[model samples]
Target: MPLSEIKIDDEVFVSEGTVGVGAVRQVTPRELTIYIEGYGDIAIGPDHIASAHDGKVVVKPETLPGAIQAHLEHVHDGEYRRPSDT
Candidate 1:
């Protein structure tokens, strides 16, 4: 599925683990951010997404760690813009 088709509040899932499910919070040219209940926010690349159906996005579980790392790096690099800052 194409990333551009994703909408706010859409659910996201992974092949394994509890990290899979979350609600779409934000989307940027570089990444899509989801707000996982109790887990906070996480970001993943559209390229890592395997499919989208029934208003949900399924991402490759193997790419999760790397996506998380990239998200953290992006935050550390001061590239992330918080909603409050807008």
Candidate 2:
């Protein structure tokens, strides 16, 4: 689904993981930011999204790491990097 279709309050579900459920709190041209109770906000792109409708978004858990990296870079202005990267 296009990011344009996503709206606030949309519920986000991962195919499988401890990610549980999250609610869309903010939307931007690049990603959708969802708030998960215990996990906090996570920024993600549409590539991992399997489908979206009826105020819900289903995503692939495997892409989570890349999603997070995008978030960090977006917010930090390239000041941070994956710890293991040389």
Candidate 3:
């Protein structure tokens, strides 16, 4: 299963490690924005997503940090401002 097939509100988890869990908040053609508790919303790309199935999306643990960074860069480029950025 690919990340492109993930549905909104589906539970996502770091299936390979003890990272964290989150819910899919938004989905786009290029990314999946997940609302991770304590970490806020992070957009994950296909490269970071290992698989998605049975109402759960598993992300590659090693790519988690990079995904978060990419999301931050994306948000900074858009009009939406994260609270911590203020």
Clashes of each: 0, 0, 0
- Tens digits of per-residue lDDT, candidate 2, 1-86, equal 58999999988766433233668999888898888545578777887688787777877666678655344233434335568865
Cα distance off (Å), candidate 1, residue 81: 37
Alpha carbon deviation, residue 8, candidate 2 (Å)? 0.4
How displaced is residue 45 in candidate 2, in Å?
Answer: 0.9
Instruction: Write candidate 3's Cα lDDT for 48-85 as tens digits.
Output: 88878777888775777875645533432434645895
TM-score of every prediction relative to native: 0.60, 0.65, 0.66
lDDT of 3 at 59: 78
RMSD versus native structure for model 2: 10.6
Which sections of candidate 3 miss by over 4 Å? Answer: 16-20, 66-86
lDDT of 2 at 10: 86
TM-score: model 1 vs. ground truth: 0.60
True lDDT of residue 84, candidate 3: 96
* Pairs with steric clashes in candidate 3: none
Task: For candidate 3, give the lDDT.
Answer: 0.72
Candidate 1 C-alpha lDDT tens digits along 1-86: 46777877878766433234567888776788887544577777877788776668777756667655455333334335468854
- For candidate 3, what is the TM-score? 0.66
Worst 10 residues of 3 by lDDT: 70-79
Clashing residue pairs, backbone N/CA/C < 3 A, model 2: none
Q: What is the Cα-based lDDT of residue 78 in candidate 1?
A: 33
RMSD of each: 10.8, 10.6, 9.5
